[model samples]
Target: MKANPGSAAGSPTPVVEAKPCGNTGETVTERALRLRVRQQEILAELGVRALRGTPYPELLEYAVQCTAEGLEAEFCKVMEYVPAENRLLLRAGVGWEPHLVGTASVGADLASPAGFALRTGKPVISNHLENEERFRTPELLVEHGIRRAMNVILQGEGRPYGVLEVDSRSPGEFGEQDIAFLQGVANLLGMAIERQRIERDLRAMVEEREVLLREVNHRVKNSLQLVASMLSLQANATDKPDVRHELREAATRINAIGRAHQRLYRSNDVRVIDLAAYLVDLCADLNAAWPEGEVVARTPDEPVPIATDRAIPLALVVNELVTNATKYAYPGRQDGLVEVCLDQAPEESRVVLAVRDAGVGLPPGFAPHASTGLGMRIVTAFAQQLKAELRIRPLDVGTEFSLVISLQAPDRAG
Candidate 1:
């Protein structure tokens, strides 16, 4: 086989000369000794980069390049292991035939320096590639004119990921110092690969958790719709006008609760709910529950968002106003109007909702707020829950009930 100018094959066609270390003071020996010190420096730099946020795969490349510079060989390669196939695949490498860099691989049990090191979990120092008995492709060595090589296995977290193999065109190219220095480089490489793997796994876990939360929200929406359906059926069974009216109003209120849950449950966020949509839907349901004859409700154009806790009582207030207008305001065949309005009062950091109905004005001695009626009690309770102040004024036609609620901004209609 052709040999490198400065290297010579000391033994036979394939001879692995990993015998023992001896003190040989030559210029090459001194250079190899100096390279050992650099290997330690590279390792220190790699550690600093890891702490300072260098990516994992790039770190692997850096380590592979350092090994190549240290050995000063004709060809240097680092191959990573794939446990499923029990073979080492090339990840980072240098100084090889263009076609061989990524296109070739050596079996773990094959006759190669890497193969030998993997089988025994030890390094293989071959001074003569042609005479190496354990080499899987001794003939390839002759074909590529590779006379000698030195290989070190990188043992990572679980198993040896790859081999760092240094090659030369001549024979007996590496000594004891080369093997020792190469081993240190392999050790640092192993640690970096394992660190990268752990980081990737943690990120994957966080993403998976977020996906599960969205799925949970979807399931909750379905459950709320079922409850609304049952309320609808119950309203159908009642016969008495008073009982039927009460049941229907109850069904409407229950449906509002269900719709609120539906809106909140559909969102990716469980905390804040889109107040505009929920309020529009809820107030519409309230108006439909009992006909106001000429009383129509309206909503704001821009959307507002609010926490679920504040929204619940806010929706119930809307229910009470619509119910009161239907039950008492337009008593006979008199056509009247019940206007519902919501305006964003960000300067005050609150949302104002007012219901105006045209009917017989409140009597001078009439105490609507002091009444024992169930509807009045409910309205007062909900207003208190929102930490809002309720203002009841006698309109020329009927009465106006206005409540101002503390909210984040961008008031939603109700």
Candidate 2:
């Protein structure tokens, strides 16, 4: 083998001579064809691993090993370009000392073979590194007595990732065919690196958005609670019984919305609410708000997920029904029982929410649609938004307001 003295830098200058067939019956053409097929198979294997999302470090090591095996070379390495240090770190390699694999560094200037390939986005093959004048042999290669080396730039999105280099200790020449194999490995590695970077960035973005949403929910809860407190103060200062009752009712509705935001701020997932837990908490708050009447809630043991948009409206509907019952259910007596039940309906993808009170039943011939009460109108509008079926059934001694809400498919993006 002879060196090409006039070959330009960062070029795949072939200096290989065809070896004799020896005792085997195979011709030189047949051997070349077989080697080429084997190289293609190696690339296919690497491609499959890359697509499977192999771990970054494991993928790098595998790529270098396969590259060395494909070209039948003694050494191969993946160098990661460190822009700050202006050097290339030996990130992964085979046929190198364990201490040197992650610790060794090489010059990343045009004077070095690997650096020339990375800077020019070209392939470099130094069949005679010691006598090569276009680029200097790196000290690590000189220590290993590497006579021939091939370098290819690892192409990435918008920037070059690094360099892939294969070296040999034996007195053999690296040709154009070897450059093709090395470059193929480098391309696959670069693509995998880019994909990993994109996935990591997406995860970080999602985390940042969730943090901001939680902060917004917390602020909204605080503001709603402040308004409720102000309403309570105004009710206490009022002399008219009717005005006081109206202000207190308004405060209760505002409190219900505030509590929903409180739950969202505390939850890991801000997009959905746990209906069972929310109902129980809401009933507890209602009991505290109305000391004369006891509010009880029965819900499924497991969580029922409802989107935030539907949850707030459904919560308001419950608050209105409970408030109406507490005010009108018991006329003379102060002690009364109100029950709120929430569970999955027997029908598929449906939920049942029923608020009932053991008190004087609804007025005779009363029509919910014809009623001109503000609370009833509010309930009707929100029920329409929920697309729920609202049924009012008068029991022997109480009234039951039943709402059957159909659950939609959960949003996967959330």
Candidate 3:
């Protein structure tokens, strides 16, 4: 090995030998075979890591380091092509200044090894930088005493991403086998980059969809509130008590739906909601609807998440039960307590909702489905919509209504 004057003191400089091409010598062929075996082993390990969900940055950094070690080269780098800027930005490298790894830039011209590989979509090699005439030598390369370089283009999802290059201070360090190994490494890196980009795009799309859903929920809440306001105005203008009562009840039901949508908007997840939290807010609204009753909610520590599709009917059912408790459960009275309970029976794959009022018990021999009241009828219809079994019985001091519905578990990512 000949020592370079520019090398640091006491550091061994690599010898510049004649360039090896084709299958000219047994020495080159044997070395290529050994390198190919090592390359295959490294590629297999990297492929496994990718499948196991290893971080992309860590995998990419390992790839460059693996390439440098496998080919016995002093420097290896992965550059990302920026066509918009007409440049190649260094993304990862081995044996270069630390700041150069992520911040370095080089021109994307025929004169640069990275650019030449990208432009031609093929491999390029310069075994003798001092006397090479095909392209102008980069200043950084000369400064680092680089005597040889080999570059291969990295193709991402059938499009060009950038180039992978290996540099050595020793001339003739790269041969046909080294180029082949770097090609394989570049192909592996391309696949990893493509996967990372796809994952990022999917995340962005989901975020965008969530934002749109929240906006839609806000609009729906406003529209429902507007309808409720119109119904209130009509109720105020009515002369008949029955007509006014019916109009007000209709407005309350609409408002219930609006409140449900509001909860969905605030939760930021349109697909499902924490049933316990939703009921707490809902009962507060119901309690404030009247002047003589208070509604309290009871739930487990763990959240019971129900999908929006099923939640609407469930919300309506609770509304009717609570409304009935406040109105008739304490006939001619000025004070009462209504308790709403939500519990999940995991063993039975069911969710149970019960509304109990500490007021007058059900009238002797009274039937729920046979009731003539609009609220009771609405409750029955909603229970059927939920595919739930409705159960009604008299408590020791009041009436208790229960619904047992099938539970659908949340979906998980694979």
TM-score of each: 0.59, 0.90, 0.88
Model 3: lDDT equals: 0.81
Per-model CA lDDT versus the true structure: 0.67, 0.88, 0.81
Clashing pairs in 2: none
For all candidates, what are the clash counts?
A: 19, 0, 0
Q: Which candidate number would show the highest lDDT if scored against the true structure?
A: 2
Better of 1 and 2 by TM-score: 2
C-alpha RMSD values across all candidates:
8.5, 3.2, 6.6
Better of 2 and 3 by TM-score: 2
